[model samples]
Target chain A: MSKVRVHNLFISLDGFSAGTYVTADEPIGDARALFGRFDGRVINGVHHVAEPITADRIFASAWGQGIGAEIMGRRKFGPQSGPWDDDDWRGWWGDAPPFRTPVVVLTHYERAPLAFDNGTVFHFLDADPATALAFARELADGGDIRLGGGPSTVRQFLAADLVDFLHLVTVPVVLGEGTSIWPGTAGLADGFDIETLTTGSGLTHQFWNRRR
Target chain B: MSKVRVHNLFISLDGFSAGTYVTADEPIGDARALFGRFDGRVINGVHHVAEPITADRIFASAWGQGIGAEIMGRRKFGPQSGPWDDDDWRGWWGDAPPFRTPVVVLTHYERAPLAFDNGTVFHFLDADPATALAFARELADGGDIRLGGGPSTVRQFLAADLVDFLHLVTVPVVLGEGTSIWPGTAGLADGFDIETLTTGSGLTHQFWNRRR
Candidate 1:
C-alpha cells in the first residue's frame, strides 16, 4: 500500500517546528538553533554512506525510501506569499532540485509547471491537504507520497488524519514563539504508536506510525 | 552556596508543563498524559531501592538533594483563585506532606502557616519571585531551594533568571492547550548548558545548568 510519510521534521523543546519570521534572506529566521545539528546527508539511505553513520543519521535517512512524489506548502517553495510576481524565481534550489519526482506546491495562485533536468517538476495547485495528497498519489504511481512541510502545511495534513508515518527530531533548544505542529493535534497519539530514540549528540528522534 | 533548582518538571511534546484547567478534584486536569511515566520513588534518591534504577530515575532523584525549602504557586497548593475562602482546605497532601522543610506558597491572601507531622510547613505569602526565593533561602539554612511549580511559578523564577539548575522530562504526549513554561523564555538556552539522555523507557530527560 502507498503510504504518506513525513521525515526529519525538526522541532524545538518549546514545540516550534519553524521560526516566527521567514524572508528571502533568513529562510528559517530565529529558528536557526533548532537545525544546528541537522545532517543533510541523512536524507539519503544510510547503507551507502561510509562516514560511520550514527543512530541519529540512520534514523533521519528514511526520507527518500520508495517515495515517488512530494507535496509541499507554498512557503516551503519560497518566502513569497502573494502572487508569484517573479517568474525567474525557480526555487531555493538551483537548476537541479533534489527530489527526482513530481513536487506539488500548494498555492492559491496558479503557475505553469516547471520541469528540471533531474526529473523534478514543480506543479502549482490551490488544493486542500486531501486534494494535494490525491494529486501526489496519482503522480507517485505505485510508490508512496512524501508530505514535505514548513510546519503549517504538515499541520494541515496531520489535522486531516492523512499522515501514515511521521519522523520528528526534538532538539534541545527552546524557541519562545514560532509555528507549531502540535497545536491542533491533541489526541494525535491515540491513532499512532510512537517510538523514541535519543542519540549521543542530544537529538531525540521520534517515530509515529499510524495504527492499522 | 545555596542554589535554586527545579526537578522532575514534566513537559509534553508541545511544551506544556501543565494542563489548561485545574480543579480540587483534577489537580493536573488534562495533563495526565505527561505524568504517565513518572516514578515517584526517584524523588528522594536512586539508591537503596530494590527496583532496578534507570538513567531516568537517577536524573529525577535530584529533586530532593540539598533542598531544604520549597517555593510553590497558589494553584499548586489548591485550585482556588482569589481569596482563600475555605480555611479548612490545607493541601492535596494529607496529614503527612512530602517536603520535610519549609514550603513557601505564593498567594495574595494572608493566612497563618500550616504545619504537618512530616516537618512540612506551608507559609502563605504575597511576594514576587525574588522575594519568595529570599524567604525560602532563609528557611533553607544554606541548603538549596527547590522551585516547586505548577508551570507559572517556574516561569516567573525562570524569567527572573533565578534558577540555577533545571531538570525537565520531555514526554512523548502532546497537549493541545495548557500552561507553558517557555512562553516568554526566548533565548533561554543561551544562559544554560543542556544535556539530554533518552532512557530505555522512551523518556527524554534534559538537564539545564546555568552558566556561572
Candidate 2:
C-alpha cells in the first residue's frame, strides 16, 4: 500500500505548527526565522556534508526521501486569498522548488498546472482529503504520498486519518499566536506507536507510525 | 530568596495538563491511569531505590524535594465543587498525604485548615494569586514553594510570573479532551532557558529555568 507521510514539520511549544498573523509578507507568522535557520545545512533536504553534522542537519536532511507526490493546501502554495489574482506569483521556493515531485494544491480556484524545473508541479485540486489522497495516490504510482502542510492543511489530512507516519519536531520557542495542528486531531495518536528523541540542539523529535 | 518551582508536572501530547470532564468520580480527568503507572517506583519522589532507575522512576522520584510549602488549586485537594459540604473529606491522598509541607488550596469557599498526618496541612484560601503566594511564602520559611496544579491554579501563578523553575514531563498519549495549560501563556518560554531529554519510558522531560 502507498503510505501517506509527514516529515520535518516544526511546531512551537504552544503546539502551533505555523505562526499567526500570516500575511503575504510574513507568510507563516514569524516562524520563517525558525525554519530558515537550516537554510545552508541541508541541500534539497537529502544529503548532509559538513565537518560536524548538527541535529538540525540530521533531521532537515530527511525532508524529501522516497516521496512520489504531495498534497498540500493552497495557502501553502501562496499567501493570496480567494481566486488566483497573482498569476505571476510562483511560490516561496521561487523558480525551482525542492519538492521534486508532483504536488497537488487543494484549492477552490482551478488553474493551469505550474511546472518547475526541479520536477515540482503544482496541480490545483478542488477536493476533500479523501479525494485528494486518492488523486495524489494515482499520481504517486505505488510510491508514498507526502502531506505538505500549512497547519490547516495538515489538520485536515490528520482528521481524515490519511497520515501513516508523522515526523514532528517541537521547537522550544512559543510562537505566541499561529495556526494550530491539533484542532480537529483529537485521537491522532490512538493507533500510532510513538518514538521520541531529544537532540542536543534543544528540540524534541517525535516519530509516530500507525499500527497495521 | 525562597524560590517558586514546579516539578514532575505531566502533560499529554496535545498540551493538556488536566483531563476533561473532571468530577468527584474522576479527579484528574481520568488521567489517574496515566499517572498511576509510576506506582512503587519512587519512595518519596526525591529518592529512588530499585535496581534499574528508569525515566519514570527518575522523574517520579523528584515529585517533592527542597520544598517548604505548596500552592494547589482546590480541585487537587478534593473533587467537591462549590462549598465544602463534606467536612470529613480530607483529600484524595487520604489521611497521610504525600506532601510533608504546608499546602495552600485555592478556592472560592473559605474553610478552616485541615491538617493531615506526615506534616501535610491543607489551608483553603479565597485570595488571588499574589496574596495566596505571599501567604504561602510566609509559611514556606525561606524554603522553596512548590506549585501543585489542576491547570487553572497553575496558570494563575504562571500568569503572575511567580514561577522560577518548571520541570514538565510530556507523556506521549493523546487525551481526546482535557483542560489545557497553554491558555494565555503565549511567551511562557521567553525568559526561561529550556532543556529537553527523552527517556527510555517514552516520555520527554523539559526543564525550564528562569534566566538571572
Candidate 3:
C-alpha cells in the first residue's frame, strides 16, 4: 500500500512548525531558526560526508525513499495567497526542484500544471486532504505520497487522519508563537507507535508509524 | 551557588506540561499520559535494577543530587484554590511527601506551616518569583534549590530569568489543549545551553543549563 508520509517536519520547542509571516523575500519568514540547523544533505542520504552518516541522517534520508508524489500547501509551493497572479514564481526551489515527482499544490485557485525539466510538476487544485491525496495517488504510480508542509497543510492532513507515517524533528529553539501542527490533535498519538531519537547535534527526531 | 533547577518535568508533544482541571480523584487530570512512563526510581537512583543504569537514568538521578529546598505553585501541592479552609488536607503525598526539604508553595493566601515526619515542610506565602526564590534560597542552606512545577510556576521563573537549569522530558503524546509552560517565553532557550537525549523507552530528555 502506498503510505501517506510526512518527513523532516521541523518544529520549535514551543510546538511551532513555521513562523507567522511568509513573504517572497523571507519564504520561511521569522521561522528561519527552525531550519538553521537543518542540512539539506539529509534529503539525499548524506553520502557526500567523509564521516560516517549518523543516525539522524539515516532517519532523515527516509524523506526521499520510495516517494513518487508530494502533496504540499500553496504557501509551500510559493509565498503567494489568493489567486496566483505571479505565475513566474515556480517555487522556492527554482526551475529544477529536488522533488523529482508529481507535486500537488493545495490551493483554492485553478492554474495550469507547471512542468519542469526534471520529473517535478506542480498541479494546483482546490480540494480537501482526501481529494488532494487521490490526485497525488494517481500520479504516485504505486509509490508513497509525501505530505510536504508549511505546518497548516500538515495539520490539515493530520486532522483528517490521512498521514500514515510522520517524521518530526524537534529543534530546541522556542518560537513563542507561530504556526503549530499539534493543535486540535488531541489523541493523535493514540493511533500510532512513536519512536524518538536525539542526535548529537541536539535535534530530536520522532518517527510515528500508524498502527495496523 | 545554590542553583535553581527543574527536574523530570514532563510535557506532551504539544508543549502542554499539565492537563486542565485538577481534582483529588485525578491529580493530573487529562494529561496522565505525560507521566505514564515516569519511573519514580529516576528521582533517586535506579540502583535496585540488576542491569546497568541507562544514560537516561543517570541524567534523571540529578534530581536528588545537590537539591535542598523546592519552590512550586499552589496547584502542585493540592487541587483546592483560594484560601485553604480545609486544614486537614495536608497534601497529595499524604503524611510523607518525597520532598525531604523545605518547600515554598506560592499562593495568594497564607496558611500555617505544615511539617511532615519526612523533613518536608510546606511554607505558603504570597510572593512573586523573585521573593519566593529568596525564601527558598534562605531555606536551601547553600544547597541548590529545585523548582518543582505544575507548568505555570515554571513559566513564571523562566520569564523572570530565575531558572538556572531545566530538565524537560518530552513525552510522545498530544494533550491538544492544556496548561503550557512555553507561553510568553519567546527566547527561553537563548539563555541556556541545551543538551538533548532520547532514551530507549521513547522519552526525549532536554537539559537546559544556564550559560553563565
TM-score per candidate, in order?
Answer: 0.50, 0.49, 0.50
Q: What shift in Å separates residue A162 of candidate 2 from its native position after superposition?
A: 1.1
* Candidate 3 lDDT: 0.79
Interface RMSD of each: 15.3, 14.9, 14.3
Task: Residues A112-142, candidate 1: write the lDDT tens digits.
Answer: 9999998999999999998888888889987
| Model 1 lDDT tens row, B167-196 | 788888998989999978899989887767
| Native-to-model Cα distance after best TM-score fit, residue B140 in candidate 3, in Å | 66
> How far in Å is the alpha carbon of A114 misplaced in model 2?
0.9
The lDDT of each candidate is: 0.79, 0.74, 0.79
Which one wins by DockQ: 1 or 2? 2
Candidate 3 C-alpha lDDT tens digits along B57-173: 434545554568999899989999987779898888877787889999999999899999989999998999999999999998887888999799999988898988888889898
Clashing pairs in 2: A20-A178, B20-B178, B45-B61, B45-B62, B46-B61
Model 2 C-alpha lDDT versus the unseen true structure: 0.74
Candidate 2 chain B has its poorest 10 consecutive residues by lDDT at B45-54
